[model samples]
Target: MVRLMRALREERRWIAAAGLLFLISAVLGYFNARSLDETLRAAGVWERLERAVSVIRADPTFLKAFTLIYWNNVKAVLTMMGLGIFLGVFPLMALVSNGTMLGVVLAKTAQKTGANPLWLLMTTILPHGILELPAAIVGAAYGMRLGMMAAWGVWGLVTGGHREVVRHWRRLLERIPIVVVGILLFLLAAAAVESILITIVAK
Candidate 1:
């Protein structure tokens, strides 16, 4: 736990950047909900999402829903972390896309139900999102750190600073397990809350 906290503290800047990107994209999605919806529909993503929700809703025990939510999140976070080596592009893209999707959902729900968007968010997303969002941000942050390291490593190789690059890479490798475990724990808790609370609230 202490190591996890330290690791997170060390990567705070990247996390903050990821969070800000998500916030900005979410605002954009909210304001441009109609266009975003159209785009998603065109890409078939909207249909797929609807089908996924329907499947979850059909599950009475919520076990299927929980498994789906948790595994999906785990896969996405792991993908972001793994692909972050390429200048952190994947994590950045994930932040923007996920944030936009969330905002669009909120906007659409508010429009459809004529409910206050904030109220809908509070009831639906906030409970689990409070934990899930932070976990995602942390994962993205670590990915960004890896991307930065990769960039620096390239520079180091070019400048004959092999020892420094190797040392940093080793340290990052050591911290990754701690970081990943922490993110997984957060995801697990979030999934449990979402599966129970959000499922009930939705129904």
Candidate 2:
């Protein structure tokens, strides 16, 4: 835990960058909610999301929902981290996409239910998002870091500084276990709250 914190501290800039991008994109999404909704629907993404939600809602015991939610989150975070190696494009895109999705969901929900946006956020998202969002940010942050390293590596190779590139790669690889562990812990807690507590509260 201590090591993870230290590693995260060391990469704070990347985290901040990822968070800022997400916030900005979310604002954009909220403002353009209608158009975005249309676009997502056209792409079939909205329908898929609805289907997934319906499946989860139909599960009586909540265990299926918990497993689904947890694994989905785990896969998403891991993919973001793993694909960040390609100049961090995947992580950056994921942040913007996810942030926009959140905004769109909030806007649409408010419009459909006539509920205050703040109330919706508190009741629906905050219960789990407090931890889930941070976990996602951490994953993206590390991904951005990896992307930076990859960029540096290209420069290093061009400049014949292979040794330095290798050293940095080694260090970054060493931190992966710590990062995964921290992310998993957060996701587990978040999933439990989302599947059980939030589900009950909503009912």
**Model 1: how far residue 63 lies from native, Å:** 2.1
> For residues 32-148, could you state the per-residue lDDT of candidate 1 as single tens digits?
999998997898888888887887877735688789889989998999988999998899888999899999999999999999998998987787699999999889888888999
Candidate 2, 110-184: lDDT as tens digits: 999999988998998776699999999989999989999999999999999999899989988988889899999
RMSD to native, candidate 1: 1.7
Q: At residue 61, what lDDT does model 2 achieve?
A: 49
CA lDDT scores, all candidates in order = 0.89, 0.89
The clash count for each model shown is 0, 0
The C-alpha RMSD in Å for every predicted model, in order, reads: 1.7, 1.7
> Model 2: number of clashes?
0
TM-score of 2: 0.93
